[model samples]
Target: MSETESRPAPSQLRRLPWSEDGKSAYLSTGDGASFLARMADTMEEGMLTTAEVDMTRALSVADEVSASRAELKMAVRFLAHAVADAVEVARLRGERLGVDPEAKETAEFLRRTLTR
Candidate 1:
């Protein structure tokens, strides 16, 4: 007979029953995964908000006004590198865990601003 055939019915199953070993036998790995996903959304929303772009613009302006052309170019290059590194990290993390990375709203926002 199947292992389940000898067990009690669903209606008779004890809810949230811990084993005699003092362990909650039913783990919540799925809940942990869901929580992480939600945290990712919150982070993405905060990170790519319009405020970030505004801050970038303000920093760019400050850099342009305070630094030489070469210095400003170097600073911008550093900023681009930082952005690319973050994107790659996000992409790799999503790929490893079979989840989609955050949306590319920052790129779209920049594109729209540039074309205007």
Candidate 2:
């Protein structure tokens, strides 16, 4: 057999359930959850960094029309979405694991924040 025929087809490779793109695999529920948590944390950190940059620029320069404010606003929106996604994932996971009271409380808190 030729060298190409000896290898398995790409489609024959096993893929994780969470791997939508097929290029990467999460392997398990915990692994997917960990990835989501990390993404949320990174988004939050980015928001903080953007806010710090805006504040630093405001303090260092007298210009009131700096673009940093706009960047900070965008960062805040992204962080909000990230937080919402994380909370939703947690709520679903809690439901799957028998409805933890803390998860219900968290969902209520998120709802309150959204309404405000």
Output candidate 2 Cα RMSD. 11.1
Q: Cα lDDT of all candidates, in order?
A: 0.51, 0.53
RMSD (CA, Å), candidate 1 to true, equals 14.0
Name the candidate that leads on lDDT. Answer: 2
Query: Total clashes, candidate 1?
Result: 0
Q: When superposed on Cα atoms, how far off is each prediction in RMSD?
A: 14.0, 11.1
lDDT per residue, candidate 2, 16-115, as tens digits?
Answer: 3233665544322333456655564465456556555655554444344564776656655655655555554454344446646787789889999999
Minimum summed lDDT over a 10-residue window in model 2 is located at 10-19
Alpha-carbon TM-score of each model against the true structure: 0.33, 0.32
Give me the displacement of residue 58 in model 2, in angstroms: 18
